[model samples]
Target: MRYDVNLSILFTELPMLERPAAAARAGFDAVEMWWPFDGPTPADAELDRLAGAVTEAGVQLVGLNFDGGHMPSGDRGLLSSPATSRRFRDNIDVAVGFAERLGCRTLNALYGNRTDDTDPELALENLALAAKAAGGVGATVVVEALNSFENTRYPITSSAQAFQLLDQVPGTAFLADFYHLGRMGEDLSALIANHADRFGHVQIADVPGRGQPGTGELDYAAILRQLADSPYDGHVGLEYKPVGPSEESFSWLEAMP
Candidate 1:
């Protein structure tokens, strides 16, 4: 099981432009990120600089998110929002282009919060459109489940909800984040056994506090062993919050198989 740092969370002490090198210095060869800018599209020069940073650091960018509107703040995603559908549509090409240039193949499309006026049909349609666009670039779209506690407005807060959306989008797959699922009290072991083949990528953080693996109760060794035996052949993204300095949080990496 290869491990990749999620630069969006780790090495956040540095400027976004300096993080890839910082991650490389910390001994990571691959990284993943959320959409790093506030808007759906950033200037071409900014994209070029970010791409250059990763390239210069000699790290592979394995995954990225589509503009999931102001993450950790308010909206979880724009794709499903009737008001922001146009922004979501406009972002697809630019996001796909960045992934292509960075050699990142997995793109996580977050399902937005469900409003009183939100139409489920429209959300499905938008997701399908996003998946089709990503497929054209030889990439796979991934839908992830966030915990309802933190993402109360986000509709797809469980694996079941995520699967339902994936059914509507033909070529997309699931991103099984253990921390979120575990927080929702899903049986992690059984989920892996039943849906391993459906997973495009996997992310991990210990539950309770969303800290690094050992800081909480998750049995990562057992989970990793299960993953190794399962059909999923992908990197496990370290998408946890650092308890101390980000560099010190990596002690758990030595324990991983």
Candidate 2:
């Protein structure tokens, strides 16, 4: 069971450009992230700099999310919104190109918050479109399920819901985030046992407060052991918020069995 630190959440005290090296120095050899720019389209110079940072750090860029609206302001995603479909389409090439440059194979497509004005069919159509574009570059699209408590407007709140959308997009797979499912009171063990083959990637954070593994009630060692025994071979992304300094928060890594 290998692990990758999510730079978007951990080591966030540093500038975005410096986080990859910071994570590498902290003994992480791989990293993942949400859209690193303020918008779907960023200047080529900015893109090159970020790609250079990851390369200079010598870490594998594993997973990345397509533009998920304003993450800091809690916009879950843009794909599900009719208004943002154009932006989502525009971002496909940019996101795929960046991933290809970094040798990243898994691209997460967050299902945006549901709106009365947005037709579900349109959202599905856009997701399939994104999948087709990413597939052309030999990358897989991943659909994630968010917790209802924090993401009330985001409709895909369960493994069942995520799979439904995944079915619509042929090459897409489900991103099983234990933290979100556990926070929603879903059976993590059962989910892993039943759908491990369908998971393209996995992310972890402890429940209750979304902190490091030990800071909450999740039995990660047991969960990881299950993953190891199962068919899921993807890296487990450490997506938790540190309770203290990010470096100090890594004691749980050494403690993982």
Candidate 3:
């Protein structure tokens, strides 16, 4: 499995624009990120400058997320919210355009937290729109399961739940994030054994602590072997929070089977 650092989480020691270069210096030719802007539609110049930085750093931007509203405040995503539907729609072009500019072919749309009155249909509608927009650039829209313990209000807390929602949206794919799935008590070996052919992207952090592989109870060695033997061929993203300086967190990668 090819690996790419998740710049949003891994390289926070530097300014946002410098993270790509940091990844390159650390021997990574590819990187991915959560949305880096405060708002969905950043000015063209801001977008250009960021694109230029990634280009100059000589690393490929492999994946990106849509604008999830106010992430630090626990707002998971916007696509499903009736109040934010317009905002989510408006961001589709800008996000996909940025992905296109950098040759990134995968876009992830986190299903938002559900409220007492949330409509699942609305979420599906918005996701379909996202899938269609991404298709224009030959990119795919992937959905992942987030653990309910941390994401309290977020729906789709298991791979099963995520697939239930994704089932209705054709041509879309699954984002197998082992960190959240393991938190939900998913059997990593079983998941790869069964659904490896359907994965569009993969992210991993250890169970319990959400840190690098050895920081918690995850059996990454077995999981890596499963992925290696399966038909799934894609980037495995290191999406964990580092225990110390981000650069120090990757000793585990060298140990990958």
Candidate 4:
């Protein structure tokens, strides 16, 4: 199974631009990250600096997230936020352009938490816009579900919930984030077998702690074995938060069957 490190989570001990090299040093050849700036559109030089760091590290950027507003502040994303619709629209082409430049083909668009103002029709429209923008540059736009316990306001929290969006918007793909799904007590193996065809980009973090695999209850070896046998063939993103120093958290990688 080919794996790509999520630089945004894995190498936080280092500077943002420095994480790519750190990931490379830890033996990863491909990496992914959330938008690398506080704003949707950063200065050209800032983008240049990040691109240079990735290129210099000799790693392929395989996946990227559309600019979701400040995540730590509990803003899940702008895709379906009525108050932030303009910001989400303004970010689509810019994100797609950067992804094309980095040879990345998968772009994840996080669905915002459901608010009193949430509009289902507006959300579908934004998702369609994102799908079209990414298609223009030969990239696929992926939608992901988050667990409700922590993301209490986020609407799409189950594999079935995320898969339902695929029918509403053609060309929209599903991002199966195992951590969130697992935390919700979903039958992962059964879901993998059933929805294998819709899997676009997959991410994993052991639940109960959101740490690397093997640190929590998930049997990654068995899960991975099943994933390897499934029809879905895409990079399994290591998107877990580490227990300690990020570099030291990869022992599971070598031990995985």
Candidate 5:
């Protein structure tokens, strides 16, 4: 299976544009992002520059996360508060353009939550609308499931829930996050095997501190084995923060299988 490291977290010392090169030097085939927006909004020039950097690095932009507000105290993404839906949709277009420029085929659509004023059906409809738009640009949208205990604002917590919501959208698929799945007390192998075809991408983070795979309770071996056995074939996104130096943190992956 090809590896996809999140450039933002993996190489925190470098500029975002230079991250792909660092990932390439580490023997990774591709790179991803939690989110690449410079601010609450998207910028055309910045997106162009990022796309250029990816091409220059000789690595693929395997995944692009559309989950906005991923930064500290920043809020506004595909599924944020009701008032931000318009801005969110605009950002979706910008994200697709950026992905297209980078030759990326998959884009993550993280569902942001609003507990006070929004209805579930409305949010689902909005998600469907966004998915359809993403599909138009030849970029598949994968709905992300984050453990609520860790990512408090993430609306979908379980693989089952993610599948249910994604099912509402004709072409949208699932993203099984290992760290979140473990945190929610779900069976990682079972979830992956059951929804093999529906899964478009995956992410990793060890519990206890969200470190490398080998440092936590997660069975990276079993997870990789299950993926090998399943029909799914996609990039495994590394989304955890490095406990020490970035280059030293990836030693755990050598023992993944």
Candidate 6:
């Protein structure tokens, strides 16, 4: 099982490329990001620079969040916003270019929930269109469902609902976060096994606090064993906030199968 570090938490203390190197130094094989495409609009040259960092650090940019909704002050990212529809498409085109440069093949398109009168069908249509746009660059798009308790605006919650959305879209898939799935009242192992076919990327965090593994109530070892037994082959993105120092929180990496 390869591990990835999301640079959202530690980018300030280390260089972008050094984030992966830090994880590698701690015995991880890969790294990821929430959204590394946020700089003066989006461009391939910038992404190529990021790719260069990853190559220089000898770590893979396994996954990235193409949507930019998590910014403060509650602005929904693309795939769900009408005002930024064209802008979002343009951003995704730029992201694809960056993905190619980094050799990253999987992208998490977290569509922010709309609180307006926009019909659900319209949202699905926009999401499908965005997925098609991502597929054009040979990158598989995985629509992730965030827990409403933590992110009250995130729309898709249940695994079944995420799968249903994927069913609606032709070339899209579902990303299952154990922390979110458990928060939304789904059995982790059962959900993982049942949707094994549709699972693209998996993230883990302990319950109640979203901390590192072994700090909370998540049975990560069991989950990893089950994933190892399944046909699913993907990298597990670390999307939790570190309770203390970043490296200290990940000592449990030695415990994952």
Scored against the true structure, residue 3 in model 3 reaches a CA lDDT of 92
Which residue pairs overlap in candidate 3's backbone? none
Better of 2 and 4 by lDDT: 2
lDDT string for model 3 (49-83, tens) is: 89998999999999999999899999899877788
lDDT of each: 0.90, 0.91, 0.91, 0.90, 0.77, 0.74
Each candidate: RMSD: 0.9, 0.8, 0.8, 0.9, 1.8, 2.1
**Candidate 4 residue-wise lDDT, 135-194, digit = tens:** 988889999889999999999988888888878998888998899999999999998888
Per candidate, the number of residue pairs that clash is 0, 0, 0, 0, 0, 0
**Candidate 6: which stretches are off by over 4 Å?**
10-12, 15-17, 43-45
Query: Compared with the true structure, what per-residue lDDT tens digits does model 2 show for residues 1-257?
Result: 88999999999999989999999999999999999998899999999999999999999999999998888788888887778888889898999999999999999998788787767888889888988988998999999899999988889899998998888779999999999999999999999999999999999999989999988999988888899999999899999999999878888877675
Tell me the TM-score of each prediction against the true structure: 0.98, 0.98, 0.98, 0.98, 0.93, 0.90
Q: Could you give candidate 5's per-residue lDDT for residues 1-257 as a string of tens digits? A: 77888987789899898888888888887988867775435666777778778888888888887746545663425464576566566676777777787778888876766457556766677677767777887878887777777567666788878877877788888887788888898987778777788888888888867888877887788888889779888888888888888878888777665
Show pairs that collide, candidate 4.
Answer: none
Is 4 or 5 the stronger prediction by lDDT? 4
**Model 6: how far is 194 from its true place, Å?**
1.0
